[model samples]
Target: ADDDECNNVTNICGEWANCSNTNGSYYCTCEPGFASTGQPRFQTNDGTRCADIDECAVVRQLCGPFSDCHNTNGAFYCTCQRDYSPSAGPRRFQPGSGTHCRGNHRDMANLTESRSMLAEIAAKTSGGELTSMEVISYVEALSLSSSWHFEGRGDMEATPSVINTTLTNLVEAVNNLVEKEELVAWTRMAEDLRENTVTKLLHSVEQGALALGRASSTPLQLDIRASEMELKLMTFDLAQDQLSVSMGGDHIQITPKASNGSVCVVFVRYDSLGDILKPSSDPGSADYSRFGGTGEITVNSQVPIDVDADVTNCAFWEYDLGTLQGHWATHGCERVLVNSSATTCSCDHLTHFAILMSSGRSNLVAHSNILTRITHEIQSTRTTIHKNLCCSLFMAEFIFLLFCSVIAGLLHYFFLAAFAWMCIEGIHLYLIVVGVIYNKGFLHRNFYIFGYGSPAVVVAISATLGSKYYGTDKVCWLSTENNFIWSFIGPACLIILVNLLAFGVIIYKVFRHTAVKKPEISHYENIRSCARGAMALLFVLGATWTFAVLHILHETTLTAYLFTIANTFQGMFIFIFLCVLSRKVQEEYYRLFKNVPCCFECLR
Candidate 1:
């Protein structure tokens, strides 16, 4: 009764199929994957030939949608179609297996590309070989330097981990921007940041071999903030970013290359997984411009074209590469220049610059250190002007003019003080001969008032009547613009003449007494004493400014040079005569050095 019946079921089915044995009769049965063709359902009778069933054909709604189903000997597989890829579930599975597909591979590709590009840019910032893409991104092609020529690409490079991290963050930021549709502002972000890409394959033992594009999964903010070492302050608030700076009076110029140059971009690859873009929450009001405005800028022969003011205006803007006006307006605040390429901001007031493009070679930005210094000066000026009642009286409008007035007033007082002191000296001598002293009395008080008050009245009257005479046309102080400086010169000459005459008469009397013993003055007279006394009298009587008189009257070169030379060194001469040349001062210096040597000897 045992009929050679496929015993124990060894080798009864093919390698791709399953097997089972019947009763004592020993019949064959196809397993789950293999079946009999043209039979009822998926079952097969004994002795019927077993064949592979096409699950893809029998089931119409298999593997969900946008996927391909393929039949194998004993199993079937599912795969995503073009523009779609499997994101969830097993790739090789049953026909009705639940798997998902993603559609934003381009966004991921864009991210990967931009990240690589950024890394390349950061590397070049320290000075090295740069690609055309970097030149475009830096907008450095518009710079004044001729060295920014194009270097061909084709090297799929890896950058420092920190730079890679920066690129990764930037990619995520742009991806977020894309989701919010704010990217529509910039040439549809110039084709959603498209660029060149190269793939990298990796041999993974556990997961078999793999391939991918260079990119980061780490998300980032659209507002780009490079590391402090990389560049100046930069930010993009979806629509605009603000940079506050003050360049001291160094001439500013925004020099753009203006010439056309080649361009390049970055890319990454993931062979099996491909690339993907994931959407997040919409950008909140805090991350973007509040008032509706134009993100586009226009430039032709002039600076930035005037945009509608009703549109939201921020403090700064994103600028294209070019020469810009940076117009510091006295009227409106519409002068927030985003990309500044100006080389000539003024030395006065809060200048609002206009962001404009430039061509050819020139410095494109101002230094913040210089700007900060200027701001400090401006603040100091404000503080000083605040203390003056005259400034406040005029509502602080004529500060420069006031500064000129102050200098003029000082010059007027110099001569007045000298004349007053000299007159006092003469009166003191007369009183000494009469055997009288007025050190403390109504007379002394009156002398004090005349010495100080007279000069004040003179300067005040001059300033009121001939205010224009105070300063030069080009500068703030007295100049050759008019004979206005004569207000200072005229009094100086008169005082010199008066002092000379009075001192000369006094010196003549002393010399005559020294030449011959005078009545009851034999003990007070000597030729040596007379000469020394006369010199001292001339010095104390303010005769040093005598040469200056010759200078003011005659406009000859010798006189001019002499006048300048004297005045220029007048302070030094005073120091020499009073402190350096004095016998007491000489003794003091010797005493200092002698002590130093004595101390050293003691230490030894």
Candidate 2:
């Protein structure tokens, strides 16, 4: 009965076991990753606890260069080596560090590759072996001189020191290539000296690296050096872009060259015409006809033309370029010549002494050879043009006149005032006809102001204002061509508006006064002609303004003359209409013109 009863527990290990009364017992032990302590602490579960082990301390000197392995509680850290400072940029690492360690072999492989790549680049650039004593010296100097420093460092690194080291190394290579006699030989074979300088310099640099070994290897740093070379070449190329010439009253010949050494010759002929175009028996040929000459002539490299033999039309133009009478024929050199052709010559003209040059160089360069000469010619020509135009004196006078005219009176304002005077005249006429002036004393004063003093004030103001707007010109009057404001728009509109209103008012007064009861024949007879004359004057004023507006919109030179004619003769025309033609006014005008003094005592 006791044997039939069973237990559920079982002994599972030597120290720690599981027991089962009815089943078999088993032994238990700790795994290889764990270690056991002999002493057991009194706890609730009573399980065995083992501390983490440091394997690195146990296995020393196993990790390779560029890597460090560390052990912590239950963990370890393997860090990759850092070449540059953290602040310099991101670090180049073979494998990640911290927590997940890369194999030691992999880290070593990455470091070797990095070093090899750097060596290859430096070798290709300097045309020297990376391991050579000279190259190593310069590389060490560059590292010390670099403008970059380690993080948290105080002293600033020197960039120029590194550049100098690199430059010295490159210069040494250049000298080596030159000493080999390759540079001199290549330059001798090259056509252009400039090209030889550039090509030989470039090829020497490439050859320099080859001398240092790794002739077939390409380095990444070669791109940087090539870029620097390109920048230097471009700067030199732009420095010689333009071709300049100077024709100092002589004939010149020159050959121009491209960057590639292709030759082109340019001939230029400069002339001066002064006494030849003077007015004489040839009135029609004075101004425009004698001023005939091409402003400039340019041609490539060509043989020089004989000034004495090839020159034709009149001795003055015989040596000129592109003339109507004189022509050119090519003789020897491949030249672009500007020969004196009769087609562009002038008779009785003063011509500049021709300059003829024969050389395989540019006309502009050989002519403007000296910088001091360039300065002198520019200054002299500027002074001559100003003096010849008479502008030196004309400008001073113009400025003086402008100030005086403006202070005296503005012309356009006077024009408006003149229009106001015309209106006043119309009003005076109306008042006279209406018999509002019972006394004769007012007539003299009113007529003087309306006819003379008002016009004078208006004229003064208009003239002053006009002078300000016009500044200076060939003629004194305002015209569309000169861009004058007062003479064109101001006077034109003012005249039109004033005349229209005056005409309308007079017409309306005549109609109103005669509407209700017919005035006596005497009244009618006295005002009729005056009214007609007033109307005619207004019509003429309007027509004058209309023409001014038309000229402003469409500047016809002939119309400009018509306006001048109208302005110049207006005083006489007005006198005819307003004075001599008017029967009432004509008697008074004739008496005034006779210069006869009236005597009241004589009548007595």
Candidate 3:
């Protein structure tokens, strides 16, 4: 049995396909289906066994010609799907190819349109039921302003699906909201636009404000509020107080009212130096305040050497601003007083009045501190010009040498020289009163020249240079008399720099003197006090120049007009500061004029 179980030998010729090995002989009965290669059909000692065979030739026609057919040794199969279709071509589905045919352009366009529509709908509805994409689109278009320029890149004639969808969504939302609340959805839309902080939004807001004002029951209050807002937002103050708003039961009317007060207030303030200071009093009369003069003077160029010393009203004065000297006097103002006498004069107690006569009682303060400082500037400029002339021939060789020199002087007086002198005067008073610096040496020689001459020389140089090269407008003289220079910028800057320097020096000196701990030891106890006074003067100069430069540089006026305006009230700042800010100056002011100062306590 062991030998039979163990393979000894087998024959394939066994009678059966199944065969078993024995020690000597082997017999094989019929096998199940196939016989092994090593076994004999009837031999007992034969080798192998038979295994079942799978033949699919019976299902030969399972797949049609659309598929390929494959047959194994005992099995066969066929694939007949569209993927394997013969007419589908080489690139359709291959061993290693990816190319495939797609639908036409119409299909793509329809797809894009649907996408756009969905996007638009989402935007318009902001997603009540619309797609999430539509909500995003609406949110993006909400904040629009004119600052952004739009590009028209898509089809011109066709309405974008996105836009259409958005509009539809918006309409639906409005209808729903309106039916629910009876509120105008359009107004809400406008408000939304306004909230976006866009330029167009803001502009719309402003227009809405105006419209609201027009529709309001009380417009005067609205006007006042609007005016106040404007003034607060912008640096320049408008002449609006003169305007009156009246409600006559039915309609509201707004109009300008002329100034009609008989009693005029002449306020006087001074620095410690007994110099008058200027301050903003009234916008209507901003051109003339304190020591400043307003109005125009014209020289008759056509007149052959006039034998008569008479100043008459100009037949044709220009206000067009384009022509030379066109901006001075249009038809000769009645308020203007053309005076031949060179004495200090105030016309009708108005700064706007032309000087026809010289009366020391100009109903105006000299703005003494400012004047003194300007005087000093003139002196400094003169020294500088002198130095420049000595050092280099540029001042002489330049065609505008004279013009520059004149402007330099003008700028000095107008800007710094005058203010510095005023501060010095303030210092003098502080020394005498507070610190008791009674050394007679304190009042130095050449004080007046330092205060006045320096500025004049500097202005003279500036004017000379500007006139020769830039233009033709005279300083301190009539425009027609000498077409020298109307260049206000150079002169104004030089003046500002000089005054700023002076102001800094005075402030530093004051702080320095006050820092000393031994106040009682020194005989010049007034040093600190003098410094304070100098600071007061500095304040006046600083204030005036700060505002004045702006007014001068503003290009709203022509050359002649600019020059005249700049010169007219240039000294008013110091005048107001000196007379209004200081007690001593106030006393001096009353003493000199024998009149009550305007709003004295308020000035202090």
Candidate 4:
């Protein structure tokens, strides 16, 4: 019998090679995906070796398009590229797995199919031909389609036709059901379900209008449940046309402009929709404490309405495709008419238009008073604490009279350095908030150079040129002599001014961005956020130096007090705004406190 060399402990084969035993002889051959260095077959002393063959390097288009080929030690595998996925099986596979890279189309396909089905349903339900069963089916289909998450712009673009068809069909269906005395069936559904249906309808309508993109020649009109909608397409010439749409005693008129482009006006009047979509009362909810009353078209009686109240706002549904959230916004639309019976809106562009009636002047006045009182109390407390702290620092400075000149020089350098870093912080903020491009490595290198080196150079030049003016009699600080104090004051003031300008731009950009991206946010909330941002910038950028400069230019007790308070409490302000208010820091604090024994005991 032949010796089984293939199964022996000390096989006569190199790694990745197969050993074969025959009539009193055995041969070694490299396995698939590996190559023999010396020969195809060898004996124990033939000096043959096996090595992995990089099949990916040798083969082109190994994984096909929209895929990447990765080489392994002995073989190669394929994976779909970003934004693409395999049609079947695992994400990574060999060539023979029958899997192919494909663009994400599942959401798009569902939306497209749903839209087609809706169009068919609308055609069948038109002209008072709707039944209760058919109405239920339509609602179920719309709800199911709306529940599918839209992935990107492609999905949004394919959705407008579905929404248009839905509105037209829904209005007709409801009207027919009412005429047949079958409306009570849907009305008897759970309030939450009814609200969800209406909300989804509103969301679909808003998204459709946003994604409409172009005007159609055909007109659309709908009225149901005390709500009405009229959509018309017209060639709007900036120089020659004024578009007007009126329905259900409400009117919209606009002077067409070049910027308005080809316009399509869609008007919708909702009755019970408002009752369902009321603003949330939960304090932690996004819609909590909104400036307006319930999201309803009717007038609110809780707050007084003036003859020229500005309480009635011309608004449109602003929908964010990314978040799939819709909010009533008054940015582009304006109220042209307001009365007891009806309100008219005028807009530069076209969308789902409506009227938002708010609680008027009393609320504004009350909020303002409360904010002013709180601000005053905070200022008084901060001033008292800062005054005592400054006095203590002043006394300590007098005690350090041993090296007055050295102390003054160090103080000048340190203050300049602090301002330099503030300037850098402003630049960093601008890059993050406004600038399109940001290179971390580049910023890191430049920040160290300018933040530290610039202050060092300024101090070195000042000490060399005006060393005698380093100390004063009253304090171990730079003297007010020969305009030499400018070395520190000049740079400090400039940095403060630059930072202020940067902050102004940042606030403007933030407001504009919020308006565009978050149109659902109320004006009051926007203003409050901007105010908080400005306050944060004031402390972080050391803008209190402006008060100091004001006192220097023309001394006043108020300016002196203001400067003292701001400068002394700056660190606390930084800590409060940057750390205490930080969401991540708050979460960390919660996690830490939760693990503490005292906290556990307290909870127990």
Candidate 5:
């Protein structure tokens, strides 16, 4: 007789499969809600395997709208999405179970729904069934609902009650979990998950406290106690003078600056959270690990102080919502006093406050002294450097003043000389373009005498008339007072008018030459060159000074800007017109840079 292989100890069915016995053989089939990898029926040795079928993926809206379908092994379940709940039946249901999710819009408007939700969360948390993801999801849902209600109603008066209920219940649940040691696993979880959970809890509490403060105009104090934790909230009108508050055993004194809003302070003391938030042994871990292992005191004064500890820090939870992370920071807080039983803190702002203490007094004090010495040395060096810099600046100003008078006289002579040379240029261009008397040697001699000799005479007369007007306290230029400025502007305007007249004549001659047919190439080129040079000088030398004159006369924003730009780019215009646009100058530049490896390649 054939043996019943399905019933034998060495059954041939794979995991999640059922074995069936036939007349002379046995085959394997996947169990209900699972599918076989190969054929529906096959022997175990044929590489056939059974896998749980994903009903949710295969069927659309398997859990209906507004719900999330959670696939399980050989089964599936459904739960409502955030801000929704089942209209009927249990929270977790199956597809087509006559249960539909309904929006909690109306429910979230009042405190009743929030109370029920908080109660549920509290029960789950206390029962050790709430996960980190669930906690975060629930808090996010509550926050979203609160924000939505406020946006819809344009008020948050009703939100404080909901927030208050959430806080009270959450504290109770966390306290119960602490008593049962269920939260011990928090420290063992992944670092990111642990931090996210803590951040959410702290943020939720802070939001509740802020809402309460805003809703009430008068001073308010709420002290909530749990078996293993305590929460203290205080709201008071901000004052210019220092104000102090004491809670548990900690004390905080803050002098708030003038503000239009009230100040809300929250202090949470979690005996178990401290144990779970143990400092990492590795120094290179997260910033929270750097906190000492002594103990934590919450809000003004509540936790038992560790007097023997060497270091005490008054810190606040700095949460960055963008990154969804938080860490204790002592930026605006100072440790005022620390004794055997109590610690005092002073802060410049309001927030969730705590006291962090560490033992090992000898090592800490020694290290602190070394740090203090290093800091003092750094500060002293900085002070010396600053003093030296100030002295150098003072000496520089003094030296500048001492030579300013001499420089001003030179500038006056040079500026007049510049206009005198511009006048020579206009005359030269006029002679070239108009085919008038062009005496190279005679004109060159006269150019030098007029440019240099005339400006020297002007400077001499001006200095003799008013030597004190050569320099002013603000600048080394000729002073505007006592009509001294005209000494320079008058000559500048004369040169500018001469250049303009020369430019107009050159343009007329060029246009007349262009009208001639079959004109001499040499004459044509000369006229062209003269026109270009004349136009260039007209703007570079004459137009800029014209704008300067306008700026002095009208002093409008447009004239000031135009004058500034024209002067600033004067050198650039000269280079472009006299060198970059000139064929002879281009050849010279190429020859100069041809020997350079980079320039040679670029030129080639």
Candidate 6:
């Protein structure tokens, strides 16, 4: 009972195994850096098969910090990183040998000697001396490099490997008077050596012998070429909108005529930055001999530069992104705004990008907050280019532009659907107001055919004539200037005019037949208020629509503004007549909202 467990098995078990005693038996287990190879075992040290383990595979990165680990079949080894040296002895070590790397590469001899002496003193002090293992762990923690790189600071951080963060824990650990003075002396020596190394590197960089960014003394000049060679951004005096770009130019811009519309900018590089950054065979030289760029880019680009809006689609459009969902999966790169944060997407990754323009009166609101949302969409679809990804840049741009045209054609069909309903409402209003009696089945079927079929015929005929009809200037619609605007304007005006005439005829009929009661005034009172309130209802329905017609015909600044106002109020008048003034609607509104106040109070 008094004999120790380890003492009893010390002879049978090899140094690599630890033995544990159970009630009537004892088992030997291999230690941390050792394992059994499934061999038949005997109770003697020679028969027990405890073998060295490859710590690199077991721990993933089992070497000392700031070092590289290499694995062998049954053993592992570590080598210090660049500008670092081993703390124990030289710059390499075997596994289970403990921490072997520390900072201060330029003065390795002096710093290593000082660290060793301090560790020895800590191991053999006044109290119970610390073990060699404990001293190594303590010294390793104090000697490890702790300086962090600040990325946003860019080239300013300078990344000098000679300097290392101090071991503040050592200042507190040493209580002996002699050891404390030695700690201060070693700290000063390390600082002076680091400063001297940094000064030398700096001097070499200034003399053009060392390249800090792999950049040359002269700024790199890039020859810029563009697809639309003659295009230029319009000056403010020309129209207040434009786009263009030039390399080495004082000002950069990119745009075409509003009617022509849209352009793409591409970035190109001959070789990757990583390749140029590699060290040359000559120690003092770098491989970045031919790479050139002053590294300046100006956005100065605009969408729908001189383009105008039309009736069919919005001057601003939201993409139907579902159509493109799986088409881009094979590119190994996702669509993102060109920027450096996309580390996984190298500079050369290609993507299809489109700048779809809105047709809904963009000019008036384009420069204001109303179009700020459209600007954001353009930004989200903007392409990101990396230095390595210069290939296929123009091809992707062309593909994206073609995709927009196809999407616009599909969208034009949906726009025609709205006309389908507008025509139906007009025909129904005309028949009822004119007092034309017909079978419900006959009238409904004919109007439905005319409503849905007429718009489709117009769209197909216009597109067959030319798909460009929908790609007027900025939006996907009938061109305002190409007489194709008539596709929407003709049907819209016909519906509005027929309804207007119907309202007029109804008013005329009401005045001719109705008689006023002579309660307030004589016969003149009846003559004075012709049709009484009938005229008011007729004007409410038809007058708002007349404003649009007048604006198109006159095409004045005042009429342009008047049409914008009329368009906004048109929906309001429809809502008032169809819902607000209707008896059934009034009842439902009150019923739905009657308990709203009570419900709100309960929630509160």
Global lDDT of each model? 0.38, 0.34, 0.32, 0.56, 0.61, 0.39
Lowest summed-lDDT stretch of 10 residues in model 4? 284-293
lDDT of 3 by residue, 4-102 (tens): 632444444433355556666555655543434553344434344444433334454333433444554433444334222233345223322322332
Model 1, range 289-354, lDDT digits (tens) per residue?
A: 101111222111112221211222222212222322121122322333322122221212212122
Model 1 earns a TM-score of 0.28
The TM-scores, one per candidate, come to 0.28, 0.27, 0.22, 0.34, 0.35, 0.32
The clash number for model 6 is 20
Compared with the true structure, model 3 gives a TM-score of 0.22
Candidate 2 ranges with C-alpha deviation above 4 Å: 1-241, 244-416, 426-470, 473-488, 508-531, 534-536, 539-543, 557-562, 582-604
Clashes of each: 37, 62, 119, 1, 9, 20
Give all candidate RMSDs, comma-separated. 32.7, 35.0, 33.2, 24.8, 24.3, 29.1
Summarize candidate 6's per-residue lDDT along 1-604 as a digit string, tens digits.
5455556644456667667666665567776667775533323444666788767767865775667987765566799875456778656686477666665422223433333433443444324343323333333332321111121324433332211111111222232211322333223333334223222211211111112222222222223222211111111211226433332211243333444322223222111111111112211111011111122222221222212322111111111222311110222222222211111111122221112222224432321111111111111100111100111222223333455444554445443444344434444555655678878766656755664566678778878887665654455445654566667667667766766675667666545544533455545655566544443344333445567687666545677677766644544444455435555556655666677996544433
Model 2 agreement with the true structure over 38-95: per-residue lDDT tens digits:
3322111345445455655766643434345577665555554432122222233222
**Residue 122 in candidate 5 has what lDDT?**
65
Best by TM-score: 5
Of the candidates numbered 2 and 4, which has the greater TM-score value? 4
